[model samples]
Target chain A: MPNNALLLDGTKVAESIKETLKERIQALGEKGIVPCLATVLVGSDPSSATYVRMKGNACRRLGIGSRRVVLPENTTTEELVETIRELNEDPAVHGILLQHPVPASIDEREAFEAISIEKDVDGVTTLGYARTAFGLADFPSCTPAAILAIMKHYRIEAEGKHAVVIGRSPILGKPVSAMLLNENATVTTCHSRTRGLPDLVRLADIVVAAVGRPRFVQGDWLKPGAVVLDAGYNPGNVGDVDYEACLGKASAITPVPAGVGPVTIATLLKHTVEAAEKYGNR
Target chain B: MPNNALLLDGTKVAESIKETLKERIQALGEKGIVPCLATVLVGSDPSSATYVRMKGNACRRLGIGSRRVVLPENTTTEELVETIRELNEDPAVHGILLQHPVPASIDEREAFEAISIEKDVDGVTTLGYARTAFGLADFPSCTPAAILAIMKHYRIEAEGKHAVVIGRSPILGKPVSAMLLNENATVTTCHSRTRGLPDLVRLADIVVAAVGRPRFVQGDWLKPGAVVLDAGYNPGNVGDVDYEACLGKASAITPVPAGVGPVTIATLLKHTVEAAEKYGNR
Candidate 1:
């Protein structure tokens, strides 16, 4: 075991970020402003419901208001968009998050597009994504932002690093690749259609596994001393990269449960706080 | 000499696309609709003026109306955006093209965002860029579309190929990377900040050089049998790739004069006709 591998503790980083946000939240309270996040879930997918509940609970812990808007599985796109627009107009809502994988019958993108850009703290809208790609976003998607937060906390330099991202998801893989590129990393975006994935992974200075499979990336796939960020959320707390297998090769690695997941929720609360600060300034 | 490299002739590909658009333009003509592209120029830069003239000539050849709105070099961003808004609301203008690199004092992106999404044939707006990234744009930026048009013309499959895009500019390099990823090509984006540029290029099955430097990419940088698309338009009709040096290594390559340039203008015309057809259908 090359037990020299440094564990990138995402929970510690999240705690540090939340510590700063806590002071800011209290400052906002003195000014009679309460940072708030409104979460909308269309279907009763148990996992999604739990995710939303977790996020709301996090916001409450930070002294931010939480509003839950649960809709039936049969909710039409029009109705969902209407609900989002009302939230957009609501002065009390600093941030809005619509749970992903809305029912198949709904036009999820249309509903996402309907969220006002100012209140889109979750960064689900197309405009926010573009802003992030252009390096001008105030609030990027929470998960990608969390990844960056982890890197920043660890002082990981991206300049001149060849980072291979093993996914092309709009919010996760794509956004993180763009952010890494902005940070001056040579970014390679690969998806399931890519040929010889293992051979490609062997050349990475930084490997981001976001393929959403359990232990899909073996230790043999990684270059010696490479930094690995496993962004996948598979069942039973297993990450996309085999944590045990990669431990011998990766110079630093994030564990599944305490890794990207908690930082993601913390990043969401940070965005909400930032949005509220902007509103308070106004 | 290995002088048998097949030229990926952009001029011929552009001609075929124009041939298809001619019939569409004539059909619109029958309906008393002239597909008009209103171009806005914010300054008197000589190159910008020449580009506007060239685009207008191309439109004239295709029986499309070209409207020029030239502002003084000292025009403010608000003035530029207002001009774009007027063109956006004009019923006669089916498409709008805003020549880029507006004066440094201007908020170019803000002005671009002012153009209505419907009339933004040039696809310079943030929303348009996001759509392009997501593979859902009605009209993507012309130069990137031009590169794809050339590839589709040659029937070179992007699936499973490793494509290295040597630029990260918003309208060109970045957009093309997204488009290639959408086509299932593993895309690596590199810029001036990238280390080992030549090594990265050598691994690519398809290399797109948009670095804007004259003859910056040498033949030694390419793998034998690689497809090279020189998107850089430098002074004196030179391209980003060293044509003579690359000829022996490239199995297929685009020449500067008849390469990506002609195809780009043709794509602008195609987008205009498409926009007009949409309005005509209404």
Candidate 2:
């Protein structure tokens, strides 16, 4: 049988998104407003540092100002919140992104909640999450927004589709489920506690893998020609679904390195520019 | 055939919950504290007024103080918000309930969002909704909380259950779905936009009807031996599901008038007492 699967090109979609953002950023520049994103990192986690650096580089490429706040390993929640409040008060900063996995001892949720709702460009705040669920959010969690952007770019309709979301993390799985539900999709959220996982996956017209396990979804588990979105970027350039295996069964699929990741960074940059626009106008 | 269905007695569960609240209310009284609930009612909507009054009477029965802030038909969103802010500032008022359908002219969501999170016992605030979604809320929206309270009272575990929730109203359908998902249930949220609703409902081990249409859910739509929760209260005492029809198919079911409604009011009282307990001690 001939290979007929269409690769959902997220990298190309991300480039188109960035192109539009470039014009918006220029308009903000003309208005004497530089869209600024402040990233706060706690402790010395190497991977976290790399993510922060990548985000900062994305902002720079878009001609947006970037601020990095690094705290010591033992920084308390109170200290982290205080730093966020400072960034919130700074007129120059329009958006705040607090890198997750902030020291295990520290209260991470509290720190995330401390970011001002208006400046929560990463959509980490509880208020922001609620807004996103209600279909009233402008800047939802980046990865979920990126997923939607990809689908929109491809003109894939979610209405009336049975979308099985494998994961329920507040940031990735839950928000994306809410987004799809709002877009008129019948959404089922399955997690680690879910039983008969393969059976549930087989029922889906659309499959989203955000369960964090590398290549966890088997090709045999999917309904033939189902649209698969692998949001999980695991080690060794792999994703939640076996790429080669899914290529045979999936009508459309997102590859790991170029899929979801680039679009996610682009969505973040887009949100920062939007935040600055809203701020400048206000 | 003999009906093998279990009637999930919500009234009995409510009585049990109130019995516990009575003791807590008495303890607060010893400390010279009365758990006060302030209800903000805008305009002269007859049904809305009745709901507010019923809630007030329930508070009185529990020995909690009740304050009614009734505004004229011409009240603006600003005035409604001001009234709620006064309740928030009043140390005597531990909880606030804003009756919905507050004139189509006013921004209902904005007014609900004005209620302080601590005093939002009815759980209408965006922050409260988000908190409930994350399983970190003290007081979730009353109807959804009541549904869970009844389920817990009967020791019906939600974990690993395939629960299908009909309707997507923020207060009832959406929150209940989130609560069930947090309980480790594989939850599917469906709404008016959902296609093949009957097929989706048939896949559930548990079904929640919040569609607001009278007798909309037929018995054949349910999986045999499913646990059904009817959260809808339509005019003429009719519920979303045809009660007699569902009784044949469901292993457990909550009836209309005697089920979720009474428990919902009782849950509001419980939340008020809880808020008072938290406040009085602080």
Candidate 3:
């Protein structure tokens, strides 16, 4: 019944993860391995460009090598897949990240599958998905993994709790639900087609708002003591959950910009470092 | 609600599917393309052997070829994977089934992944799982696909319905939950870790009992007039749901022996014929 809800500061956690990765990167350097990440961007959409650049910045900040491959908007799926294959074969590239929302002309799933599972640091490949579902993940979907990392950092218990995950996007909603299930949380995955959505949301002990629609989940939809993790990064700095209203009801909440976003980038970089260490040892 | 719930007859449905596949097989026979399924069974587990035999019998009844590779109980993971690889490369083999519960000595996942996604008739491979999740499945996990087939045949509306899937096993609980979500059903997947299990189950319009524990899901857990699909095939013809109790409460229900079991074999055979047709054109 506390008036002030605890904030899950993802920026602070991401920074802490990056610091740990810096030491690991330096150790790899001593062994003649420069932990390298290759990022593929198919179009020039401003937001996608920003995300790609942000990832490059994170890699550089951790002393890891970064390669950005920007393809023309008219690039064919085969061409993009070929480029990823080259990255897969390159000894220096320990990890591969494909910027999402590729042009409509391209088959994104095909392109994602082309990234070698071994170097799938962004965890976009089907193989990685299966591994994550089975709890043997080497590189899980970054955003979901980041959310779990935040929860773990705060000692949040998922066991014997009901988690409502809105949206069913393969990388975010679906993967996160599986991750939560692996942690022993009863997971309900709701989408646009779900009926009585508010009723389902109210039953959750923990609510994760991942649907892209801005402020789609209202405060009154949540159980009073529910823990909220907002993974949406909508335009104008808004999230799926109305933060102002949720702050008054939820026990804990993650703010949009400073929450899942920063930690996602951190997880991608951390996986890159781990991939480098594994690939080097092999 | 009627006291007599309509039994979802899997044996009858399986027969109907097989009759349709029979003509397809005859057409392929004239074109010199004999649809062949290769089943790899490791160890002498009696139940596993029986299941494999049933699948082979189904294929034979449909005029499709079946190849059985029986590996020793002590077969190493590499050896079993090699067998699957050969089956994958064989031109005659249109489908591959690796009987479940492969001796504990083998890394089952590694063995399952070795079956090419093209020939994963039983839908045990990770690629098949990914495809099933994305709704572009060539061959989905047979048991789950069979459940959907039964639901569809009976005109059970999945869209906009709340579905509670009780279990999280890779082939059954997890895959079926994904299938339901793809059909636009709001899906809640629960297992032993779930809190307030009965309460969640009561909210569901459709309840899938796949937990494998005999009569684990009590009838009282279901909402009145809910449709129930019991996928567990335990000894003595017991199922995950307490069938005797559920019959009075459910609008429709699948009986233990005459339900998911027969339809599962039918789906495997159906996929085999489809795979042959696709592979032949290629």
Best by DockQ: 1
Point to the candidate with the largest TM-score: 1
Residue pair clashes in candidate 2 = none
Candidate 2 C-alpha error for residue B241, in Å: 1.1
Clashing pairs in 1: none
**RMSD of candidate 2 to true structure, Å:** 1.6
lDDT by residue (B140-169, candidate 1, tens digit) is 999999999999999989999999999999
TM-score of each model's chain B: 0.98, 0.98, 0.98
Rank by DockQ, highest first.
1, 2, 3
lDDT of 3 at B68: 92
Q: After superposition, how far is residue A210 of candidate 3 from its true place, in Å?
A: 0.7
The reply for model 1, stretches above 4 Å from the true place, is A280-282, B1-3, B280-282
CAPRI class of candidate 2: high
Better by TM-score, candidate 3 or 1:
1
Residue by residue across A1-282, what tens digits does model 2's lDDT show? Answer: 736578999889999999999888998999899999999999999888999999999899879999999999999999999999999899999999999888898999999988988899998888889999999997899999999999899888999999999999989999999999999999999999999999999989899999999999998998898999999987777889988888888889999989988999999999999999998634
Interface RMSD of each: 0.5, 0.7, 1.0
- Candidate lDDT (C-alpha), each: 0.92, 0.91, 0.91
